[model samples]
Target: MGGNGKFHKWKIFYRPSPSKSDETHRREPPPKEFICPICECLMFDPVVVSSGETFDRLCVRVCRDLNFTPSLSDGSIPDFSTVIPNLAFKSTIVNWCSKSSAAPPQPPDYSSVERIVRGLMSRQGGAEEGKSRIRCTEMELIDAVAEMPDVNLSHAVTELAHRVNHFYSSSSEESVVMTTNPPTPLPLATRPACLSLSSASTSDEILNPNPNSEDEEFVAKFNSHDVYEQEQGVVALRKITRSDEHCRISLCTPRLLSALKPLLISRYVAVQANAVAVLVNLSLEKTNKIKIVRSGIVPPLIDVLKGGFSESQEHAAGALFSLSLEDDNKTVIGVLGALPPLLHSLRSESERTRQDSALALYHLSHILTNRLKLVKLGAIPTLLVMLQSGDLAGRVLLVLWNLANCAEGRSAMLDQNAVEVLVGMLRRNEFDSESIRENCVAALYALGHGSLRFKGLAKEAGAIEVLKEVEKGGSERAREKARRILLMLRGREDGEEGDRDGILELGGLSRTRHRVGGGVGKNATIANSTEF
Candidate 1:
């Protein structure tokens, strides 16, 4: 579905002939050395008749046995005594077979579908399942289904969705509940607030496997095992992801997500994590955000973020971050108490977990209400530590900038000595990107707006010289900001003129755009030089 005409580099097999009119000349077929005269398939156990015609040994033997006189290519009877095995042809067949076997296995075709069906049946009760039990995982089966032709795959998805819908509707609540493990109570601080929230809730034509009977039977068997069902659900989700945008939107139904939520309580960490990962991927499409959030995925996801394994926590944080992009979901996540775990993740050993946590905080802190909660949870000190050493310095700085927007946040930053850290970042040549410097200077400006003590703190941390250099040579946005901070430090405004050594409004400026994360569309304007 995503095909584009950019495959010229992959056109390695053919070079178009310069003579376009050469279509009049037909190309000859390949040499017969690779073909067999009788039984037509690629030569295997080939024998050369006395007439020097090559035929499959089994075909010749069958013909000879079926008739008293088997006519050869020369129309002469061949004596069984004269027919010796064609050693060279046999050797060629052996070599061909060897090479074929050594090559990597191609993607599954019709036969693979048959194998997958057999595996499913064997899981129910089939002899072949034992023989090939180790061959394909549930994930591999889902991948193979997704790789089917577009029409067949879409049909498969639709059929599977219908079956899931049926199972959900027909099965009693008690039955479904019995299939899942009892939910473990989350910690008081991390427990989901939405626990009782009433949330509104592949392939092939013969390469087309039988969807109803096999899928139904397999799902019925899968229902008895929580881990297996979670695996199946995860694979189904992964298959949807491999499809096109339209397909993803179509398959990510509320019923499907509702069916998956119970799997979060499974004893298997892999299952819980995979379910959250699927939700994260599905939530990337903005239209799906409300459906997922309303599906009651938020509570379980927050629970996973709170205490699941590191991988699961990372995905949960990412999901929350993306969901928070929709304005309504920000309060939903924040009220559920997502801040503590997200803050804890900032100190996690896994870099991915740390970054996802920071990103979530970056979004959460954008809310004025959230900033107060975050500062209370000690976000300022944690962010300062991360700003100094974490990989998400730019993100950390942006969050700090957001917090610096209000009086309470400004108080928190002042308490955390944020000015010293931000100034230190400005002073390091290696630490300065346009975003980093701009945020640093703006933050310093915010922190130093009215507090002489902070102004002194910044100067002690080498901010004045950095501001002078920024005013002279940094981006225009940074320069203007530096001009403002310098003016604040010098106790003057744009109209005030000064001597050569004193701060002055620099002119002939190079204009440039500067945007801090999460504050892009809002004012690029800093708070008043007297707000603090």
Candidate 2:
């Protein structure tokens, strides 16, 4: 937005005055100067959609930001990719607005509440607008509507809310509406009530439409809604969640969560991706995290992980990553069967998917209960495959390091030949970050505490040479761990047998294969002192 002074003058000049002329009064023509369909004002930075309608670039950009698809006549929608700059119109509007500063003020055509909300919900144009602009516009329009006292205003709000809801559902309407041209406006009585807020029930109840065929006609309508709206609607929800604390608090209601639950399982790819994105942001607040878990989103999210577009998988994994930070969520996610798909994601072609999944795994592994669960679920082999692939080395190493804390995990690793991989990584010495080497050393140290089979496996793989090299030049922590591993290996070679079952203690926490009595059991106390 520019200086309001010039813009205010421009607005006054462009809008028609009541007493300008008899000819203008008798048969008024729509403004020859193109008015923005969005703000209903003279276009400054004029741009045109493929439909031949021109609007302020900023207004059109707001549409793009919302992911709303612009509807056109003839039952067709223009591909945003075809939107172009109106260079000639831009020159004209700029000159007109510049000269209008000297013209007299006239009453502007205030857009109706319905129009304002519709514009907010309309498909986004091709150009991207700033988040600040979108937020400001949303706040101004919502505030304006809220200030109105007319009963019709409430009716309009209810109508608009329903329309917006229909715009997001996973129903059949989306497909039909998207393929057809924009339809003629229906009489008020004929309009569907997809998001109607009834006086008989609370907003939360209205928000919770039936998951299995909402006990109403509109829920079926929801099942048959347009695809474009479904995509943009969730995108808008994602934006709202990240807008500000006030907005986030308002948007993260039980009603809203109920609404979003079906979207996680939506047939629409963008809908699923954006829904996961919103969940990821919502889970940042502790209260929201609890609410999200309770909403039973984990199972559907795992479904997305198992089979979704690469981008959606990333978002689902990211959401899980955020949720995994809470202890309660860890058990719930494990019980709900989120691990297998997560393991599957580690094998995805998309680096971001792998990264997000690995991060989620790392966080979940922090919970002592999840470590054994992960190991038993065949995490060791999957992790070994990831390690051999050479991507996510640091992340994988840290997760492996955590898993190696217990005997079952260590034995699983030994069975998976993790010693060879750890020694191989140490032998490379080409790492840019010392953390990678440190994790490798920590894991090796954990393996070294296993039975004689483990130590022989390491020594057989030339661990002594790599340990000496790392001890000489690695980070101080790596150096210390490497030295300890070398000493342990050499001591064993020298016929010294000292606590072979216990892992080497790193600093305060003894780093060994296992704690004295801490083994993998339902009540096992896996030490909480381990740090990556």
Candidate 3:
């Protein structure tokens, strides 16, 4: 995804605490005010309430008030309460814990189980375990305590959370710890109620309300008329794109892609084609990059391109284009024969699809320079077919320019006799349309750029004459690309070693070679052309 898919940088950060010497300036200045847990000053900022296990004491207090029991760590509340006083809860709890030295946790039985049992465990074991916890026949004593009057189990639950959160908030200083990953602030109501057993309404939490159900509903109801329309014609080749993203996403069992292979060719073309493009882009995303690429999904994309798709071929072509540039991606695309359909798309009626197709070819042509299987795969014929089409002058020019710009097709250019077709397009009789003139000049430039040897050949083949005509017409892009070709051919006439100086040393020669709308008399005339 990075430029040329070669070199990329990832940023990482390390936070080193300031040393003691610099602590005066860097350390968090001591809390400007007491961040009391009861007051909920800094909202779940550690309160440092008597640390070890104060919740056990609160549980005892509730049990005492309920006149029920602690369902103690080992015994009922009454029995556990007798061992510790209400005032000395902390010391008693610690001493009792120390004396008991809680037994190490028991491990689950891992002796060999039947294959069927293992499968059951894998599938339904979690549900079974939850059932066991809630309805165990052996825990009669535990259930009886749930009936406790003063307990108000909901209040106790809220109180316990409040006390725990309150205790922790008071534990840490009230300084803003500026970090990309500082702990998220607890909800105001939850934080305060969590500390000291308060029941205040949560302003932040209550206001935001249900986030998902409403979002899902809104997303469902949102207008998809636009999505449906967008997926029509050339864009409709991406129908499966809107099918999953905008319209069908609202369906009960919506899918971004399908596993049940489409039944009809039309279905496959509509859904699979867009899916191919979607999968390609998703493969570029940071979140989906690893999963998508590793899943080996590209083979199907390559298949679609290779097999061909008249309705949605561009999607596959574009995807294949991108995949060819990526590491390990070209293997499948190459095998599935990605080049043919992409070439077809360049001659497509839809300009958008053709552009994407051409762009992919250009990208493929510019890579590593050793992937000549693309060039040998009849890329020249397909490129010329698109280039020779009268309707595609602009697009054809771009394709030719890119082809001639790179080293990938240099050898193929000479071997395939591409120069003659390109030179054939460099006609000067009809230079009235800026587009035709520009395309003519571009084709010449592409031919001239192949090599020093080709540059002279291209000039002799009338590339230089077309350049003079286009420049005479004042087409800026044509003039620039054309001027470069003229300078390159002049340098080529001289030996490659002697004076390689080309565009840079054109100051004196420009008066004769570039006279805009007029000829420079005999000075710039070629051998066969009369100096009229």
TM-score, every prediction: 0.51, 0.51, 0.39
Clashes of each: 3, 35, 15
Q: After superposing candidate 1 on the true structure, give the runs of residues whose Cα lies further than 4 Å from its correct spot.
A: 1-226, 450-453, 493-532
RMSD of each: 28.4, 26.8, 30.4
Give the per-residue lDDT of model 2 (tens digit) for 1-532.
Answer: 4775655444445766566565445653335556665566666566654333565666555555555544433333322322456666666655554554323223333344235525545443334222212223222322332221222212111111221222111110111111111121000011111112222112231233222332233223224466444544555445444433344444565446645766666655555666676676566555566567755456567767776656567678767776776666776566556777888888788765676678677767766667888987889888887787777776787678778877788889998899998888778775545555666787788776646787789888999888888888886777877877777776643333223122122211222222223443334332211100
- TM-score of structure candidate 1: 0.51
Tens-digit per-residue lDDT, 1-532, candidate 3? 5788688797889999777567545544323222211121221112111111122333323323433321223321112212122233333433443454422212212232123233433454455434322211112322222211232212111111122222211101121111122122111000111012222222222122122222232222122233222122212222222223222222211122222111111222332343344443333222332233333344344445444344235455544443444434433343334456667666666544565566555545443332366566666776676556654454444445545555656556656667666666666343324544555555455555537668656756676676677567645665765666677777743222211122112111121232223345444321111000
Best by TM-score: 1
lDDT of each: 0.53, 0.55, 0.37
| Whole-model alpha-carbon lDDT for candidate 2 | 0.55
Better of 1 and 3 by TM-score: 1
Worst 10 residues of 3 by lDDT: 186-195
